[model samples]
Target: MLKMKPVTRQKVNIVIDILMFVVMAALAVIGFLIRYTLISGEARWEKFGSNIEMTLFGLDRHQWGFIHLVLGVMLAVLLVLHIVFHWKQIICLFRRLTPLRPQRYALVSAITVVSLLILISPFFLKVELGESIRGQGERGGRNVSRTSGAYLPSESEDRTPLSSEVLNELPQTQAIHQNQNRRHGEARMLEIKGYHTIGTLAKNYNVSAAKLKNTLNIPSDVSSNERLGRIRRIYGFSMREVEECILALQHSTGDQTQHNNSQ
Candidate 1:
C-alpha cells in the first residue's frame, strides 16, 4: 500500500478526532432527549399514532436514530483508521514496556474489563424490548386514527369527527367522540366476559381487526388471539382508549347496517 505523507496523515487524524468528538456530543444530546421525552411518550402514544414528531433540531426520533447509527458506524471506521495511524507510536510504546510480568497481566485484565463494559452498556440501557419499535400514545398530536376510514378527527382537536359513512353508525360513536363517557352498562371486560382477546372484541363489535390494530397501534406481528389485558399491559396505554376506539367502530358498523336496512 502507498504510504500517506506524515503531514497528510496528521491532518487526517486531527479531522477524524474532531469528527468523532462532534458525533459523540450530538449522540449525547439526542440520547438524553430520547431517554427523557421520546422514551416516556412512546409507550403511551404507540397505540394512538405512528410517525409522531419527536423532534430535536428538526429531526424526529426515527430520523435521529438513523443518523446516530450512521455516525456510530463512521466513528467505528474512523477509530480503526486512527489506530492504524498511531501504529508506529503504539508499537514503540509497547516495545518500551519491560519484559512481560505480573504487572503486564494485570494491565491486560483491566483493559479487558473496561472494554467489556463499554460494549455492554448500550444493550442494558436501551428503552425497547428486543428489536421492536416502542412508545405510542395520545401525548404526541395523534387525534387522527390510523384508519381514517374508521374514524377522523373534527376540525377541533377536542372533538373527533365521524366520516360521512359513519353517520350510519350507532349514535354511540358521536357521543363518545365529543368526549362523553360510555353508558352505565356497556361492560366489556374480563368480569362480564371471561378474558376477551382483540379477536373476540373485534368480532363481537363487528369491527375490523386489522383497522383496530391500526387505530390502537398494535404491532402487526402480534397475534389477534392476544388478550386485551395483555395488549393493554404490553402497549402501556389505558384500556379505556382501546374500548372507546372499538365502540366507535362498532357503532359505525351498526349505523351503516341500520341505514342499509332502512333503504
Candidate 2:
C-alpha cells in the first residue's frame, strides 16, 4: 500500500474560493427566480415552493436572514483572503492614493467605504426589509401576501385583498398524506427472516441502513451482530406476527408493482 501526498494549502484555498463563487451564483439565481417568477405569478409550483419563494425574495420577515448571515460571513472570509492575496498591491494603492486628485480619492474612498458598510451591516442590523415590503404590498393593490414572494405595489392603489383562494388551497396536506402512506407501506414491506443483517435488510428495502435503524428505533443493547431474539425483545414481535407483517408488505408491494407496470 502506498501513502498519498497531502493536498497543498494553495489548492485548498482555490477550491474554497471556487466553491464560494458557485454558492454565491446559485444564491443570486435563486433570488432572481423567486423575485421575478414566483413573486410576479409568471410561474407557479406548490406551496412549499412558494414558501421557498418567499424565503428567497425576502417576503417572509424571517426569510433571507440565514442567507444574509451566511453571505455576510462568506463576504468577510473572501475579503480577508483577497487582502491576504493582494496585500502588497493594496498597500501600494493606498500609498499612491495621496498623489491622486483629492476629489477623485474622496469619491473612491466614499464608494469603497459605503460598499464595505453594506456588506457588513446585514450581520449587525436587525432591520426587516421584508416586513416593510410586505406592509407596502398590503397597502397597495397587489396581493403579495397570498404568494410567497414580496410584491411591489404602486403608491396610488387600493388596499383591497386580492382573491387568494387558489393559492391558499395548495395541496400540501394531500402530498403529506400520500408521503406518510408511502412510508407506512414501505415499513410494512420491510421483512426480516431467520437471520438477517441490518445492511441486508436495508438493501432489500432499497433504503439506507441508518434509515432502517431509525424507522425501527433499534435499541442500543441489540448489537449489530445480534440474532432475531434481540429484535423480538426490542420490538415485542412474535415470529407469527413478523411473518404476517412481511406477508402484508409483500402483497402491498406486488400490488403497487402491478399498478406501476400497468400505468
Candidate 3:
C-alpha cells in the first residue's frame, strides 16, 4: 500500500485548516451582508425609496445566498475530511473519556448518530405556516418584482397614494398653508411604507411632521423617529392611512398654490 509521508500529511492538514478558516470568515461576512446590508424588501423600500434589488459586487441577495450555500457545503466536506484524517486521535480520545468498552462504543455511536441527524433535520423538517402579518408577504425576501425592478402593489388596499375616501379623512397639512407660494404641484408621491418613520416621511415627501401627525391623529407620545409599523400596531392606524394623508397633503399644497396664483 502506498503511504503518504508524515511531512506531506502535515502539509495537507495545514492547508485544510487554512481553507476552513478562510471559508468560515467568508461565511460570517456574507451572512452579515445578507442580513444587514441587503435587508428585507419592506426595509429596502423604506430606505431606498423602492424595493430596489440589493446587490454586493454586482450579485443580488439570492445569488449571494447561493454562494453561501455552496460555501456551507464546502465547509461540511472539509469537516468530514478533517475527521477522517484525525480518526485515530478521535478513537483515542473516546477511549480516555470512558473505561467500559461497550458503554464507550455505544455512547460514541449514539452521539455521532444524533449529531448527524441534527445536521440533516433541516431537509426533512416540516415548515409550519405561521399567521402572517398584513403586508408581510407582499414582497418576499430577495424575491421582489421583476417589472421595473420596483415594488408594484396590485390594485389593492395597500396601494400608495391611496383612494379618495381615505384621503378625505386626513386634515389639510399646515405646511401647505404656511408655504402658499411654493409650487407643490411638483411634489411627488412618496413610496411610503410601515417601516418608515414620521420624520422620514416629513423629510422625503416635503411635508410637515407635526401636520402629518395631525392628519393621522397620531398620539403625542409617539416619537417622530418611531417606525409607522410599531405605531400602527399600538395606535390602531394603517400604512394605507399614512399614505392617504401624505397624498392629501401633497394635493392640498398644490391646490392652494393654484388658488394663490389665480388670485
Q: What are the models' TM-scores? A: 0.38, 0.31, 0.56
Q: What do the candidate models score in CA lDDT, each in turn?
A: 0.59, 0.45, 0.65
**Cα misplacement distance, residue 246 of candidate 2 (Å):** 60
Over the stretch 171-191, how does candidate 2's per-residue lDDT look in tens digits? 323322322322221112123
Q: Please name the candidate that would achieve the greatest TM-score relative to the true structure.
A: 3
Candidate 3, residue 5: lDDT: 64
Q: Residue by residue across 176-233, what tens digits does model 1's lDDT show?
A: 5554322222222211122567788777666788867766778888898987666777
lDDT over C-alpha atoms for residue 216 of model 2 = 48
lDDT of 2 at 231: 69
Highest-scoring model, lDDT: 3
TM for candidate 1 is 0.38
Candidates ranked by lDDT, best first? 3, 1, 2
Instruction: Give candidate 3 regions above 4 Å deviation.
Output: 1-7, 131-190, 193-215, 218-241, 244-263
lDDT, residue 37, candidate 2: 46
- Tell me the lDDT of model 3 at 20: 93
